[model samples]
Target: MNDNLAVLRGYFDAMKAGGPPAAMPFYAEDVVLEVPGAHPAAGIYRGHAGVGEFGATMARLTGGTFRLVPEDLLAGEEHVVTVATASANGVSWRRLILSTVRDGKLATVRFFEGDQALVDQVLSA
Candidate 1:
């Protein structure tokens, strides 16, 4: 496994162990995070500050039930794609986050939600 892949693993492991704060160390200072859909948590988050804001926004949107559970991790030359499920209440939605890494830190993350309807319902509820 490469360093980027290892970082991806560590990110997920940390997320599982704790929460978003645990994974923030793996992100670059100028990291960009894109959360999809037309909900409260759907926006463009930038930098380490954005990481904390994004988590806080998600918590509020999901009423503190939102959780990311990674099911797969794929690594390329400069990217690591994590297939994770975002669950809230009894609804679970899958998403693919393509993370671009630079200097052992995640530079960007683009999220693709598998179940947009479910995501909408959960976040809009």
Candidate 2:
């Protein structure tokens, strides 16, 4: 397996083990987190602090039911993509996340939701 894939896997493992906080080690200090939508959680989050806030806000907007469980990791030269599911309100919204890694730490993340309606329902409700 590529080191990037392993790192990505570890990142997901961290999330499962300790939620967002545990995943911090895999992210750069100035990482960019982006969630595009009309939902309250949608926006650009910068740096470690911003990423932490991103996780919290997403959880709050989803009524504390939001979680991303990665099922697969695909790696490129400097980018990794995770196939994951965002679960909330007993619904699983499949998703694709493109993560840019620099010097073994995540620098930027862009997430694409497979079912926007499900996400909106979870966030808006």
Candidate 3:
């Protein structure tokens, strides 16, 4: 893993271990998180308020745990691809997130959930 990828992974690992507060260090002031069917987060989350809201929602729906486990790490000129497993809600889903990093911070993250059927079943259960 390159420096940026390592940093990004560290950020995600922190989220998995300690929730939002631990993940705050990896985001920029103008971070943009694009989760499907949800509004975008377009600014700095100084605390865990915004991030917590998002996590709580997911937790409620999943009834298990949701995490981003990077399978493939690819660094490009300004972006990276992190193929991860989003397991929770009694289901395991695979997804790919394309993120653009600027100044060592995450500027934008575009996530594509791969198994819509499984995700729907879990969320609707």
Candidate 4:
């Protein structure tokens, strides 16, 4: 793993261990986070305020117990692709997260759930 990818992984690990605050420093001021069923962070989030809110929302939704267990991570010059399992609420789902890094911080993150049926079941329950 490159230095930037290592840092990004560390940030994700921090989020898994604690909450967003642990990973706050790894995000740029203008970070964009896209998740399913949410638009608060779809576009651009300027400064820590937006990043903080995005983290808070994630923590709330996952009951602050979300973890990303990376199966594979491929790092390019400007992007990193992570395949991991996100587990919470007594359920585990596989997801692919594509992240773009700018100046050693995360600029944008897009998540793709590989199994829709499993995701649907988890969401519906």
Candidate 5:
């Protein structure tokens, strides 16, 4: 695999193994994470601390049940698109992650859910 793809794969592997804290090392110092929805965790998270809060908030809101299982990764020169299943509290939905890598680090990530309302309902509960 290419370096960028490898980097993303490593990040995802870290996440799967140990959650956000384990994945933090793959993120750039000024990384930005954009999460879409009307739920509490839906917002733009900047830097390591913000990303940590985002993960913590989601975990808290979901009672630590939220999980992501990656199914595919498509890479380009500047970005990688990840297709995954996101689940919490027995509800599951397809999630698309658009990620950008800069200088071998994850610089930005924007999440797109297949069913926004379903995700909102699950998290809001």
Candidate 6:
């Protein structure tokens, strides 16, 4: 695995081990997460605290049913693209996540979801 992939591996491992709190260590202090759509959980989150809040908000909106399962990882020097399946409220959608790595940590992430309307409907419901 490349360095970026390794970092993401650590991040995902942390998430699996202890949720967002554990994964915080793998993110840069000024990390940004951009979640798009017309749902309650859609927004731009900044820093570790913001990321935590985003996770919390999603969990609250989904009643803890929100889940992300990575199906593939394509890594370059500074970017890692994760092909993942995200599910919440019994609805699932594909997510193409582009994550930027800086200083051995995640600096930014933007998500492109397949079937945005379905995602919006499920999360908003």
- How close is each model in CA RMSD to the real structure? 1.2, 1.2, 3.9, 3.3, 0.9, 0.8
lDDT of 2 at 51: 91
Tens digits of lDDT, candidate 2, 1-125: 88888889888889878877898999999899988777888899999999989888877776787667778889988999999877987888899999998888899999899987777777888
Go through the candidates in order and give each one's C-alpha lDDT.
Answer: 0.87, 0.86, 0.69, 0.73, 0.92, 0.92
Question: 1 or 5: which has the higher TM-score?
Answer: 5
Q: What tens-digit string does per-residue lDDT give for candidate 3 at 6-32?
A: 767787788778877788878777676
lDDT of 4 by residue, 1-125 (tens): 59767867788788777766887888887777766532322344456787677666556666766566888878888998988988867888889988898988888878788776665555444
Superior by lDDT: candidate 3 or candidate 5: 5
Clashing pairs in 1: none
The candidate, 1 or 4, that scores higher on lDDT is 1
Give residue 27's lDDT in candidate 4 (0 to 100): 82
Candidate 1 CA-lDDT value: 0.87
Sliding window of 10 residues with minimal summed lDDT for model 1: 15-24
lDDT of 1 by residue, 1-125 (tens): 78888999998888878877787898999999998887878889999998899888878877788778788899999889999887887788788999899999999999999988778778888
Ranking by TM-score: 6, 5, 1, 2, 3, 4
TM-scores of the models, in the given order? 0.93, 0.93, 0.76, 0.74, 0.96, 0.96
**For residues 46-84, what per-residue lDDT tens digits would candidate 5 score against the true structure?**
999999999899889999988888999988899988999
Stretches of model 4 off by over 4 angstroms after superposition: 16-18, 37-47
- After TM-score superposition, the amount by which residue 19's alpha carbon in candidate 1 deviates from its true location, in angstroms, is 2.2
Could you tell me the lDDT of residue 76 within candidate 2? Answer: 85
The per-prediction tally of clashing pairs is 0, 0, 1, 1, 0, 0
Hey, what RMSD does candidate 3 come out at?
3.9
TM-score of 3: 0.76
